[model samples]
Target: MTRGDSTELAAALRQWRERLTPADVGLPAGPRRRTPGLRREEVARLAGVSVDYVVRLEQDRGPHPSSSVLGALARALRLSAAETGHLFDLAGVAVPGPGRVNDVVRPSVLRLLDRMQDLPAMLVDARTDLLAWNALADALLGDISAVPRERRNLLRMRFGPGGDEHHGPVDEHGDRGRLDRSSVAGARAALARYPDDAALRGLVDELLRSSESFAALWAERPVEDRRVDRKAYDVAGIGRITLDCDALEVPDDDQTLIVYSAAPGSPDAEKLDLLRVVGLQKV
Candidate 1:
């Protein structure tokens, strides 16, 4: 299986290529962005790697990757699906496929979410799919129960404009410009793994068809999740709110557990309480 290193690198190349974006995710495309996708140099900078190393890997140069390098690549490129698996495979780690929910939250982790009533908390599967969420957090996003099961994805919502008009809880702020820019970065990062994924491909097509900004960024394919990134939102009647979005790594699963909270009992906290009242009143 060690010889499969070339295959891994080859997969990574395709994944990386599909996930890159220039100027969208802070990668300067210069005058050569006509083709869309990564420019090789951006991958190097984001992954903390040498340009030559990226070239070698992209070309299937038979280089075995170290764990640290793989982790760095995963973070830098916002790799999803096959891309993450390929990274692990290059490093001789086993990878799971789509819809593979091997993650089971420990009691201690669940307890942590329950105790932090001041915030919105939920667990997302490895593919960045929301698996479970507290009621307060659920209100932040639409009725989690009401959202279509398949469309419960963050990157897809933003990148795949046809998928959903709004980002889950992420767009509570009214800064459409900021949301547009950041969503492109996130989509580029998240799609690095499954370049050929039908679902992902569909979303990309939708984005390209809808927003001009999305079309430009989609072409660049920048990758990197930077999961803990912060965003502001202006939900209808909710006023302005800020939430700290972070990914908590869990064992045995690629799912990310998330928590959202306002600054120490801020007005946003009361707003969340209001959300509960309004959300339940309709039921």
Candidate 2:
């Protein structure tokens, strides 16, 4: 970046930092704080960077940050997708294009998740990386929060070794083969759309290396995207319940919101109500 560009970037960073409060990002608002927003140390900790680097960047003395560093800072600052692209531009890094998967969840989508309190819902990226889920989803599926961020992928959990060890409801439909094929097909379709995405390519490579079944299905060159399906889960202490799984598309971001619900007044619906109570108790 040019000197003038660096100056503007520095000023923008400072302004962004100062506009946010500790509560905005789940940090405690400590007493007797002189700063109007998050402290430099807090930002460094959140972004996994050194305090000195944040200082130098704010002062317009730091070198242009790499794309990964800029991404981390964007997430740390809770920047909107547009703001993230602007930050990349300021750093002279190419913003993720149509060839890449957009993993950033929009704020409005998150609110939609919040509003869907009666059913199990989750948001996943184009590659089926688990992004966010409501409490009902957490209770129905295994406690996904316990999984490491890098390992919290739907296909990885289904196909990776020891991935099924999580204690919770198990798929009782006896349709693993079909599910596996469809998942692989979806991944293949995502790969076709985002041929330049390193993470998607890496995931496909890892699965091919690790799973014989995945490799066999992938060899068939299946390329279908996920839509609506039926899933049956055997919840512990609640018996078996079957639910309709619907995939809602967010085409702009290449994301899907999956919602699990049962027919009204059906036995499964009653089971879901019980599960909601169970979920609240755990929380």
Candidate 3:
């Protein structure tokens, strides 16, 4: 980036940092604060960077950071997807393309997840990486948060080794071929969107190399959004329960928010309420 761009980026980072408070990020505000919002140390901690690095970034004196670091910063600052894209531009880096997947959740999306207290809701990017999920989602989807961030992709879990280990409601569907087709199509769509994304390319390559099923399906070139009407689960305590599944699109970020709900006042609804309590405890 040019010197002017670097200066502007530093200014923007400082502005975002100063405008947010500890409470905004779910942190405790300590005693005897000097400046407003979260401290630079707190930002560094949240972004998983050193305090010195954060200072250099704010001062426009450090070397340019990688896209991953920028993504972490964007999430720590609670930036919208648009704002995150702008931050990357100023930092002399291109925003994540279709292939370059990042799991930075938008603040508005997080708010939406918060509002769905009863049903299970999860947010994923075009790459199908699980970004943010509510407690109920964790319960119904087998606690994606339990996995390492990189391994949280749905395509990976569905086809890779130990795939059937996740004892979630979706596992009860029994239609493996349909699920595989949908996954391949989703991955293809992401590839089409970001042909130049190395990480995305790597994921595709890895899947193709590892799974004969994935390779054969990819060769067929099937394309469609996989939305199913009803999903059944055999919970130990709840026995058999079914719910309607909907995949909503957040067009701004090219992300999908999956929501699972049952009919009101039905037996499934009562069981879902019981599972909500179960899910909250697991989270």
Candidate 4:
């Protein structure tokens, strides 16, 4: 590889690493130590790389890191999506494009989630991966964090089993067919967006083979606009409540910010408020 800003890249990585603590990454703070931030070994463990590799990168004493390595480092450091892109650029690696699913949520989108405290808000990538969600969303749509990263997909929950009852697309209104069609159409749109992504392709292929409905829908190639829709959810302890669901697309990142809110002063709104309080305690 051609020599680039090795020193600058090293410095940047060190700065980011030094600014983050173990608690930020869901690790215990433990007893006080000499280092202000995490150690190189801790970073390596979190990033799924070896201590030697992290040392090499930080000391500017080895070859350039790969895209996957950089991605792991970005996640380990809790960098914003934009910061992750910058990390790739600093390493002379091309940023992931539209043809790839970007799981990272923009900082602006996160801020919006924070602002919508009373409403249920979530962010999902093109592949339907649950990138981020608010507490209200966890209450209304079930806890996305409880599932494995690969299985935290809306379409998967839709066609899979009743086990994911809380996370499944089915509402209290018994609209399984409608929800299935929407999932199929959403999958089609994702396929059109990232035709070359192997993971996405594998998912579609598996669905086509396993689900006859999915196969039929794939044949039809129907596309639906899910920007705004009405949904009724049967949340535990709250019975059934209908809410207005709006999906705001972030075209640049190929992600969608989905927000669900009940009408103000409606009975459903009051139930949602109660859910928020209960959900906070449960989560």
Candidate 5:
């Protein structure tokens, strides 16, 4: 990277960091006597880097950051797609192209989730990483916020030991098999689209080593995309409730917004209303 690029990058990083608050990134706004926006240490922690590294970068003395580091910082700062691209440019790093899976959820998409307050909705990337979810989804699908960010993947939860603990039970109509197959098929499609995504490749490798069921499904070489389906969840106080799960595409980011809803005036709808009332207490 050129010296001019490094200076611009440093200034840009500082400006971006100052424009955000702790609450924006789900961090606690602790009592303090400090400046506005997130502290350097908080940014470091959120971006999975050292405070010294962040400091060095802000001081215009750090080495050129890798693309992965830039991506992490982008997410940590909740940067928009354009802003992320600008960050990569300022760092003199090649912005990830269409060949890479886009993990950044746009702000407008998040607003869409907020508007669907009565319904259970969540955003997942192409590789099935659980990025964001609404409160109602937290009630219906168990407390996903409890799951670590790295461990909040659909495939990982489906195949990992004790995975079913949070998801409750599937319906008796063989929907479980279909969902599993769909997940595998979606992963296969993502692999085809983003052949160079190391994280996606690593997830596949981990699953192949850990899950024989995944291995069998992968061997089948399913290549279908996710589609609308019916799924059942046994809420604690409400018993079994089935909802129509719809996969809405955010094509620009290669993300899908999964919304769960029940037919109007149906018993499932009543159960969902009850869930809304109870508000994750029984979850």
Candidate 6:
């Protein structure tokens, strides 16, 4: 980043800090007649930065901080996940993360998804990148488990044409565009939180290069994720498939638990049964 950009960021941070109130930070107003806003010491203590550093930062006299330090400060300030991520972005040190996913699923969460046996359940990252799913998910969908590790990502499937991994052709004029756009929006949001992440960059770049549709939507920089949404899949062998997919953030409220439900006693549900009976799907 340029020097001007750095100073601008520092100035912005100062303004943001001053505007916040005690309630904004879950703190007391204490005594009045203080600095314009949160005290340097208060912010420093909360952010684990030295008061000197805070002053230097506010004054634009300090060097740009590393992403780790920025994240620590973000945590200390009790920033909302999206807000925290944006803070890092302004600081030009965005943390490269695709929602924390080190097998962090809670047992209860897993049990909950699994219990909805009739409905295919799966957990996807903030990027709508499928993380984990029940056996029924693999069966009802096009054996995503059969997918190689690198190609397992949902974005790659829809947009990574150069990839050998194949699913039946989805008609863009139909509902595929809706599902594709929704998922891409989720992925773009995640990329914003991790702009410097090389792996994510590669995936996004690949998708952009492979599909003109992906290219156009990516440019819009949408924020349409973080809630319940559904998609219909045209799975092979099973013929036309429709899934009422919903995104549910688990206990951590970070990772997404995307569950795909078929209507009660619907054909989709019937096809799902074949997976269990035919041994075509498992974990």
Best by TM-score: 5
Which parts of model 6 have CA positions greater than 4 angstroms off?
1-104, 162-165, 168-173, 265-267, 274-283
The lDDT values for all models are 0.59, 0.79, 0.77, 0.75, 0.80, 0.61
Worst 10 residues of 1 by lDDT: 99-108
**In angstroms, how far off is 146's CA in candidate 4?**
1.8
Estimate candidate 1's alpha-carbon lDDT, on a 0 to 1 scale.
Answer: 0.59
Instruction: Report the C-alpha lDDT of model 2 over 62-164, residue by residue, as the tens digit.
Output: 9779765776577667778888778887888887767888866676776687678899998889878876677788778756655655676888887888765
Identify the candidate with maximal lDDT: 5
In terms of lDDT, model 6 sits at 0.61
lDDT of 4 by residue, 1-283 (tens): 2335788789888999899886655455778878788888778765667789899999989678876567657766778877887788778888766568886656666656657778888778888866667778777777655554456677776665553455555543767677778888999988887899877898888778877777887898888977888778777777777888899998778889999888889998898888888766665
TM-score of each: 0.51, 0.73, 0.71, 0.72, 0.74, 0.54
| Candidate 5 overall lDDT versus native | 0.80
Among residues 3 or more apart in sequence or in different chains, the pairs in candidate 3 whose N, CA or C atoms overlap within 3 Å are 99-194
Candidate 1 lDDT over 9-110, as tens digits, reads 676576766656753333335685655587676666555567788888877774676654565466456555555665676667554345433323344554
Model 6, position 81, has a per-residue lDDT of: 58
Q: What is candidate 5's lDDT per residue for 214-241, written digit by digit as tens?
A: 8899999997864788889887788888
Each model's Cα RMSD? 18.0, 5.1, 4.9, 5.3, 4.4, 15.6
lDDT of 3 by residue, 108-134 (tens): 877777678778887777777776666
Q: Write the per-residue lDDT of candidate 6 for residues 185-266, one digit (tens) a residue.
A: 8787778776775657788887787778788988876667546554555555555555566777676545777676666787
Taking all chains together, the TM-score of candidate 5 against the true structure is 0.74
Where model 4 places Cα greater than 4 Å from the true spot, the runs are 1-78, 86-94, 161-166
Candidate 5 residues lying further than 4 Å off, grouped into runs, are 1-77, 86-94, 168-175, 281-283
